[model samples]
Target: MDMVNPIVLFVCFIVLSGPVLIVAGIIDMSKGSGTRGGILTVLGASTMGLVYWAYSAISHMNFSKGRVLRLKGRARVARRALGDGWADDATPDIEGLTPWQRTVLGEAWLYSAGMEHASVPAFAKLSLKLSAMGAPSELLEACHLAALDEVRHARRCFALARAYSGLPWSAGMIPELSQDRPQRPSPAEGDDWSRLVRGSLLDGCLGEGLAASVAAEVSRRASDPVIRETLAVIAEDEGRHAELAWDVIAFALERGGGTAKQALRQALDALETQRSPSLPSIPGVDEAFLARNGVLPQAELGRLMEECIQRTRARASSS
Candidate 1:
């Protein structure tokens, strides 16, 4: 009994189940029994089945995608660690360690920041994928610009983190981030409004809001002038990003009519429901930093949601 074989079998089972349930749903919907009770039963069962199938399918796909990314990321890390020629271009040099070991520690923090900031570029790529769903070319360009800004911010932060720690830092210290795998859109893909709304919620509302919160905290906590200034600049850029996201969402919603409004409301409600009571834990990131600086409470997860809602509502009122 190969352990890996069972995992592969389980994946196959999920793939089969997803299509089967979807087909069954269509059959149930097509049945014209001309009876209310039968219709209701079919409707209820099929709806439940579809929902379950959809959730499982998405979870499985997301997991598989994440695994592939991790594998590729590990390869990159290994190559860098092995003193590969390509690594030098991105890696930074560490100077003499401060007596306090702050240089090494700061490097770690900045490493995490770089990875997180990599999401900005990741999202820009996402915008390219989203282009099929009526996303404007300008919006995609903005995503690319935002990604560049994030990369700049990450580089600056990493350098400062190294400098403050009194470590010798140089270029090529960090490696490129792994890319998220390609995802195929479903049959319901043509629903442009839903796509825009959801993307806005995730990218603008959640991502930007969380960034702003983190930046504000970074600005508040650092005792060093350079670190403080670096954080301040990042925070200012993030603020603009968040505002730009809101503007994009509002502009789209205004032209989309009642159906779009309903979709927006539904998305917002869904976001509210999905809001967590605890903050997301990222590797090497300390909750204490956030807590100490008047940003988000370590255990709280709704900072982005709260901020998003506030921003969205304000936009609505003014419009």
Candidate 2:
């Protein structure tokens, strides 16, 4: 069966349901009844429904007959680092995959999952920091929401890893909630506001913007429907995250005065010399397979990295 784009479906669901919920909530509130709460509850339920719907739609979109959902629970596996420095816990059961392919897929997805998981803590910290800095409510909300989005992205990537390997995987030991906070540079090292702006420039503007571009390009080139679908969703979310980063930077510059701008410029200059490392080619694995599975070739990756740098530079210069 042909599958509609999960993003398109999600947008449609949001557009169709958002107004209905708002109208119903307004009507119910007008009657002085508790129906407003009910409407909000329904809206929440509908959003969850949409998430599941999109998941199912993507799962069924691909022609692969392999089982896609054999694992149990919320799919929130803990991330673990192996002795080889790889963040992997389980071996996949995918048949016909070369050892190189397995290694590539496992390592790639594990890194992706790690980043997603890490983003949860990153955003949470950002939200707290922004709040303490007296940022506007909208920015605070965006930071919190971005954290939630990262959680979803982690699960989604983990699911993709499982699908590729056809094995139930684990990330090893789960840590306490308090231990999950991201390790951020302390204000003792430098000015707090400067650190914040620099972090935003390096992580949000440069890192996420580059990731969005790569994800979008990979989505276009991916032959596997499921991989394409997953990358598409990631690309959209990452683009938004980048925008949020830029927005926060703008806000900081507006309020932070010369110190913030100087810090941002310095960070950009420091990052300018950093370049993406090229992926090593495996002897037997075809580039086609790698690309199909969401890995861009060296040439394409280099181009994307250049584009990201240029875009970030442009934004910084214009600011």
Candidate 3:
């Protein structure tokens, strides 16, 4: 059986429960409950309904309705006998792409694939750190799954690159996973918690949050069917990844006290200072063509970046 759409389920919950809550709140007030309690209940119900409506409208505007694309095949990372680190070696045969299109697609896919590979080590580090801190099993499991997701992302991106370029693409040497990895001091016996908090804030919350926002914007504007579908899938996964980051942060804060909170605030401020106005534009790339192919134009990218920064700052301040 096909799964129910989460968006539909959430909307139904809001619509059905909202009125019931409001009416019950009103009746409670009439039956002599305290004014403040009743007012809070009614206000909460109204807020939920309004928020759901607004979110639904915005999502509709940004995401086009289409049948879900089923992804097939598998891509795996293979170690080069003469080189260090793992790379995806699978190359599928594809036809009909022009040289220019091939170049654009190849570069784009390679960039994304490389980032996905990089994420593997990053997530692995996070999982180990969380494990050291005795984090709950669920969070640990999510971190492990996230690493696996990055593997899948790298494979899919490599496949796309190969298809477009009509040549094999390999994930080049990644230093992080190399056998000659740089030696670093272990996390101080008691400092693991602090390190975890900082890493989650910088990598998970800020980095993944920005990634998800950009991916969603690109998917929304993409004209190519393959590009749109692939990016949509990536955006959905990135959104969940970002949420997991925040969840980890919350978990840390619950036990981390004021020190953790202060560290997170400092991290946010530092990230804001390091922010760029937009994603860098590829030289010699046609803006119109990039837009058509799911690449965001510099102007739109800048606008979206600004919006994401503002939202992030707002959340930080409120927290």
Highest-TM-score candidate: 2
Per-model TM-score, in order, reads: 0.51, 0.66, 0.65
The candidate scoring highest on lDDT is 2
lDDT per residue as tens, model 3, 1-319: 9886443454345456667677777778778886855885777687565645443322222221111111111122233122223334444333554454555555466556656765776677677767877789999899888878777776677666655644456666543244433245354312545655666665666667767777788877777767777777777777778778888888888878887787777767766664544333343446776676656666775676677667766776666
lDDT of every predicted structure (CA atoms):
0.48, 0.65, 0.61
Model 1: ten consecutive residues of lowest lDDT: 60-69
Q: Of models 2 and 3, which has the larger lDDT?
A: 2
Model 2 accuracy (lDDT, Cα): 0.65
Query: lDDT by residue for model 2 over 1-319, one digit each (tens)?
Result: 9775443344455546755675676668777867665766578567656545433433222111110111111223345633232223332345576543554465466546655766776687678889889999999888888777776776666666654533344345445444443456465434767877877877788878877888888889987676787788778888888888899898899988998988887888867775776444544466687777777776777788888898898888898
